[model samples]
Target: MEELDVNVSSSEAFGIAEKIVLLSFISAVILMAILGNLLVMVAVCRDRQLRKIKTNYFIVSLAFADLLVSVLVMPFGAMELVQDNWIYGEMFCLVRTSLDVLLTTASILHLCCISLDRYYAICCQPLVYRNKMTPLRIALMLGGCWIIPTFISFLPIMQGWNSIGIIDLIQQRQFNKASNSTYCIFMVNKPYAITCSVVAFYIPFLLMVLAYHRIYVTARAHARQIRLLQRAGNPAEPRQGHQEPRQDHQEPRQGHQEPRQGHQEPRQHPPDQHSTHRMKTETKAAKTLCIIMGCFCLCWAPFFVTNIVDPFINYTVPGKLWTAFLWLGYINSGLNPFLYAFLNKAFRRAFLIILCCGDERYRRPSILGQTVPCSTTTINGSTHVLSFFFCQRRGGGPAAPGLAGQRNQRGCAKVPGGVGEGNALFPQSPG
Candidate 1:
């Protein structure tokens, strides 16, 4: 393909009103991405419920990556937008561009890791997920998420492999030499562009879509099995029958007090019924996360698609149109925190308290033991107390006897025995 010459021109000076609107828009996006993601980090760190769930590690990591993009990448992009020229010299330009690639790619990679986590959580055996996704393992994955993108961005751009070959290298060198160059853009040839598109966007996008589809399929199959079990008659009654003895045996083996064992361990949920209930919960969560991944794809697809095509088209795309798509990509960072707030009850309440500087609704427990101001949200008419990554039932289905006495300030009631009488099902909190 012949190199298409683009006539670059300085943007016309904006009127005061236009300038104000542009600055306000940029500021809003920057603030939302920064503050929203920051709150997510805070919630994960501070909230006992969120901290207990291992899956939330992925959420925290994702939020951190988005925070970096908001702080490091978006501000520089904003500066370029306002100035209409690369006032910052070459070293800073390289740094900004590298950080942009590093953080955005890290964000996408974190989403991929989350999808993998959800896939295993939903599709595999509970024990399998428990054994596989340890904290050390997750930390390793997070490390790679940052490391791989940094290598790709810095090595190629700095070493000039992204431009490739003699002619393209000469073009990049001459463009750098031009002290009057107005725009900050990374020039790349077909190989580097195509390779990066595959690694950063296309491959991750496909994997995420496929993972979500599999999760949906598995969830539907589980739902169907539950329906069949329900039709076959009350599977729960006998399952509950068996459940009592198991808890009875486990409690005594673990040295629960004799009096407490009888009071706590005997209470049982219909095992099949609770299993079905849990399946529904997992399915609902999978759907919500899939929707988030879909939104991310929608926001970023245009830019990555154009990113690859631009090189092949000899960079023919208009600068303004390219800028629009780039900003559209940035919109995903701003959208993620809001998505968490909208979908999850805990996040919404946390956001409200954090943003409002404390609301009266979140009152501390009184001496006589008042309501701890649990973060409850109305979902399909029923109230959901979103404590962690899982949808905790308001009353965790027939509370054990010891629970009433053991209720904590955050509304986490400790039930005796290994049985999770009033707790989230997977990875029951230690007594």
Candidate 2:
């Protein structure tokens, strides 16, 4: 009898150690997620350059959504995971589940909105993009990102719409449980699973994929144009036969003018330097955003796939697996801020400035002083310009009479200078 008692105590100690390990890991994740998302929100709010770009508005919204996920959704999830049972009553359980669904769906939708915003800015005409992505329109899209998840999350879960066919099975499990402790079982029927997964994951995934694909194509075309311009500007050799008698006689005059022209022309028409740098920056920003999207998809896809498949398989998926997938999705909330800091120079600077308690060295120089008036209008005290690539003329000069029309008659609307540099998502340079 003493031997049996000793063995039981040893097993209990082992179980307690396991629980401690689980709780510690989960607590760390929760803390990181909360702090990281808070940093993103504060960085965007404080950084002048980040505020100037309209795309960062969507990013701020995304960060806010992730922040809510960390604050509202993660702690309860961690508690339930550590305890291995839902001590909270049925009403609170439903509320927690609803919040879980609502916040995650909103986060995903923000990503889709961001992709669409980029597509419109990069692929459409400047005027068209400006008209389409007005402040009011942006507000509406941001509002929809927050509001559209309710139908799948709170309304259905609260009204008992998710357990339509599984009511009996759920009751049976509750009755047959070995312990009397309550469980927050969020089992769904096939229809609910399909509808929820479709709304929350699949549709937004499709939209994001499509938008990024178009942005990629447009970026590739712009790159090709830059390459062609470089090759034309720098030829292998001068053709002796093509030189006319006028060229031979005027050679000395041209030679005398060459030194002055060479100094001024580079600043005016620096397609090789300015244009190529701008394209490279834009391409890099796009690639970074794509990496973000890929991470989001990777984290959420497993849980959502299982969410849809579990009901069809009669809910045979193990409880541990469900918990693992759910926490994996939660980890994404913490990953975004790290990804931004590592991948984006602007974000990194802003983060450093914030973390260092407003250190001057980490702060980026203000670009507002260099702002040139172009095809942009101020709305609500914020300058909204969609055409980063479009320039007025070389050296910020006004276009000649009928020059705009002639360029419009041809296919080229964007010149090589005058407007801001780089893409809408990032600043012109690291500073």
Top-scoring candidate (TM-score): 2
Q: Which stretches of candidate 1 lie over 4 Å from their true place?
A: 1-7, 10-20, 166-181, 229-290, 340-342, 352-431
Model 2's C-alpha root-mean-square deviation from the true structure amounts to: 7.2
Clashing pairs in 2: none
Model 2 TM-score, 2 decimals? 0.77
lDDT of 1 by residue, 348-399 (tens): 5555666677776853334366332222232211222223212123456533
| Pairs with backbone N, CA or C atoms under 3 Å apart (clashes), candidate 1 | none
For each candidate, what is the lDDT?
A: 0.63, 0.68
**In candidate 1, what residue range of length 10 has the lowest lDDT sum?**
415-424
What does candidate 2's lDDT look like per residue over 343-409, in tens digits? Answer: 5567777888877898999866665656433333333222323233343343255544224323323
> In candidate 2, which residue ranges exceed 4 Å CA deviation?
1-18, 174-176, 236-269, 339-344, 366-431
